[model samples]
Target: MNPIRRRPHIDYELDAGGRRSLWQTLPTLTPGLGVLRHYERRWLRLDGFAGIAVVAYMVPQVMAYTAIVNVPPVVGLWTALAACVVYAIIGGSRVLSVGPESTVALMAGAAIAPLAGGDPERAIVLSSALCLVVAGWCLLARLFRLGIIADLLSQPLLVGYLAGGAVLMVVGQLGRVTGTDVEGETIVAQLRSFFSVVGDTHLPTLAVAAGTLTLLLAIVILRPRWPGPLIAVAAATIAAVVLDLPAYGVAETGPVPVGLPLPHLPIISWADLQTLLLAGLGVAVVAYSDNTLIGRAFKPKTEPGEKSVPDVDPQQELVAMSGVHVAAGLFGGFPMSSSGSRTALAIASGARTQVYSLVAAVCIIAVLFFAGPLLEPLPSAALGAVVIYAASKLVSIPDIKRLARFRTSELVLAIVACLGTVLIGILAGVGIAIALSILEMVQRLARPHEGVLGRVEGIAGMHDVDDYDQATTLPGLVVYRYDAPLFFINVGDLRRRALLAVEKENEGDPDHPVRWFILNAEANVEIDISATDGLKALHDDLSERGIRFGLARVKQDLRTPLERAGLVELIGEDMMFPTLPVMEKAYLTWAAEQAVREQTALEHQAVPGADEPAGTPPARPVDTNESDR
Candidate 1:
């Protein structure tokens, strides 16, 4: 036989009973590497075209965002380049473009300004350090699987934050747009200062800003997929150069340093770290929330049976973003997050993978080397126009209206968050948003909805008694459903509601008094010690009133806690049931026995000397085994 055929049959099957080694599982952890394994040549053209469009859009956009961060325009390009390359290598989202974002940029400026004391170089160093701190927070969040932290900001809160940031962006650029020195700390003061300087507005700068805004908006409306910002920037640069707009009081970017960025560690002391920790945490939360929202919105669509498509992983995103921030900090760049506009453009341009981000990064490096000087003649007023338009796009009136119509309270929360950002500061605004979200959650938990469950004539399962008029309750049973977790914060409310449910049943049907109370606990999956104590107290109170207490659909997770807390012994295992039907069967059998005992005592009372005591039977030992039957 041939040597290959003659070789003993090798057992290549994996060990069924053996555990997987960490080293063997390590490759599966980095999903981004898996994305690169199935690269298709046909996607290169689309990714290339998208990459060019993103670069064209991003160059001017980053330069515009630099104004918000109070950093030199060169810093923005470096950040975009570093973030894109790093995120492409590690990030989970295919189309999400990582770069300088308006909200985070504004937040970074606010955080670093006071510490830097008006020194641009110091500000840059502090900002980089802050980015590193944010990276630390992101890494910690990923390690702990705290991706749910993003849910702290509801959509309304996000809407409020973006709208507020947009207002601030527009207000902050008012001075540049009109060539006047308008200064203020708040929106009200800013508007006052803006009006005061209205008469002193430079006509050349105003004209440039107006023309740029109009052109950008028009292009966005007509051809959304086109590189409108690039076209507008080029047009403005040409106009400024040809007409000598600077001579007529139009400010220019002047000179932008060319070449690759030098890598350096952030020069921040331990004291600086102490001061920036809270601010860095704020930035991390805001950045992650914004990035998650954008990433989820633009996540790549999957075809039928497409095994290669990567799903959006929040924890992986945090890990990827941490890497991006670390890279940016090391490369002399400020903090960055996902840019919604750029990501949208990438998707619209037919981007298929993170390769588009890599391509964009290369293009930004090329611009740094070859096209830096060409940006010198770009008008500052035009850049302001670009920032204002980008900011304006973030304010969605339709979303606000929808919130107003559907959820008035959330609308109020959104408005409060927006006003806080505009009038106070970005950090304070975020704090307010977080506080409101927490308050909403607390209110919901504290006042959890409790319903009296009844069986409808034709319905398969029980429902809220108030929901259907034809629904009927059991003759001697009260089924109460508490639709929230039982915890310390709401234990008192749970007890109160249980008592109220009993009182209401007594008042409504005096003919057939409620003898059994059954708590439908499917929704109450979690319980705290306080809630367990409260449950025990409720059971005792029912026992004193001669009413039997039972639990339906009590999950095993909750049962373990109840058992640990000694609540299971007080309520008895026979009283706990796996489902409504089982509970009903046990309750009816017990109720029938109770009816027989009561009827026999009534007959004894009617017949003279039938019993030693009238209207009473000799007390028998409590039969715990009766419920099991």
Candidate 2:
């Protein structure tokens, strides 16, 4: 391993007089230039080897992904070649390999299939247009700095989505694998169709596919680090040519067109554009989500002493992906994204920088110009087998099992997302995953957790009364903690929980009836008019019941709203404290003072000269300087 070399830091602050910020300019212009400038010549040999390996791995995989998109294999090759060059220049990560990934291909195919109306040329045109639309979406997101949008698909949702996509990919390829006319709009329908035609499955195609699949799996299990797909594809191509499998009723990939794709805009109708816009947006979201997830996962590891991975600008990644998609669209190709498998392979094969992507592009160009005919004998079933192998790996069984063991609700969500993709459509499945994630968040916020706080013996800080058995509550004081922000949807619930805490405390010891309610507002980051009004009403209700309302750790921003809502006046300004300890001290002093005042009134009432009626106390004057004191 090379010793971690620290780059010298230069402070280049932007000034008001038209001075550009190096932070803004450098990331936009040459994202990969930093690594390239400090390029080590010794790493070139490894990059070169990795580049060749990527080419070998990418060609077959991209060609296989084309089947998912229902396009000519050459289009997939063009997509891989074009995206690689563009991403190498602008991408944030070094080893991330951009290409026609299966998920994006599946989404693009679904989006364009209706518009194309069974025409392969039209399909290509629509797919290219979709790529352009996706590029536009990426650019929009980057401009708005919506990089955090990728996190909408949480890990559990993503795991389920990919697992569902894996199932769809495998099922969709079954027709090619078995040479059966399995037809359906969805996975369930396709499975039904497949089962009905099971008797008519072509033995030759199934044999080739099964054999190829077995060989690839065996290579993966035995050698593990070898380019198993590439090796399997080559061996399958040789076997098909030598055995004349096409004559024996096995379908082959057909002759690949020789030459690079010419740069041209795909002509798309306005109506088709309108229809595809939503689908393109979905594709962009899923693609970037998957791309960034993979990018972050394999982020360049720092040396032993480093605290974090090198900075990965998500906006720069968006820009890089946009450039790749726009280039892919211009070059007669479909949409693309970062491939996790190829990226891992590149890193494992010793790739050092984006230069490896450039080398891979050059090698792919060579294949297009000279070796296109060599791939003609590759069997369709064998390609399907390769895709199946890749897709099978997408299902993270261990992750699913882990979720099941710990989080049952999230496990159900994962299963539902998986089932949604397999039973509905891939595009709908993504929608379902995103919707579920948002719904889960809203559900948590609506009924957020509440904790009753009490002081623990020998503990320095306050603790949850429910969590600690030995936690002691102050006489006549109920301290409550709301774990979520104060919002219109949850304010009512917060009020109910607060009252319930007081009621529960009183039930525990009716003799020391709860007289003060202190809210720990540390978790309440946001407040709205509805929540503010709710707080005022709660304070009034508590005051009528002879209970004082107090707020602790209230953020500075919330004070303005509380004043505007008259809550500050209702609860008294002195009732708000900056910390729990201060609040406790003030509450204890007030409780003791109230007790003294009551005892004094009682003694005065017992005297014959008392002016107040029996069982009635004279109104006390408000102390304006109490908080100041």
lDDT of 1 by residue, 469-501 (tens): 999878878999999999989988888888888
lDDT of 2 by residue, 162-190 (tens): 99889888988989999999877777788
**Candidate 1 regions with alpha-carbon error over 4 angstroms:** 1-29, 301-305, 609-629
Clashing pairs in 1: none
- RMSD value for candidate 1: 6.3
Task: Give candidate 2 misplaced runs (Cα > 4 Å).
Answer: 1-23, 301-309, 610-629
lDDT of each: 0.86, 0.86
TM accuracy, model 1: 0.92
TM-score of each: 0.92, 0.92
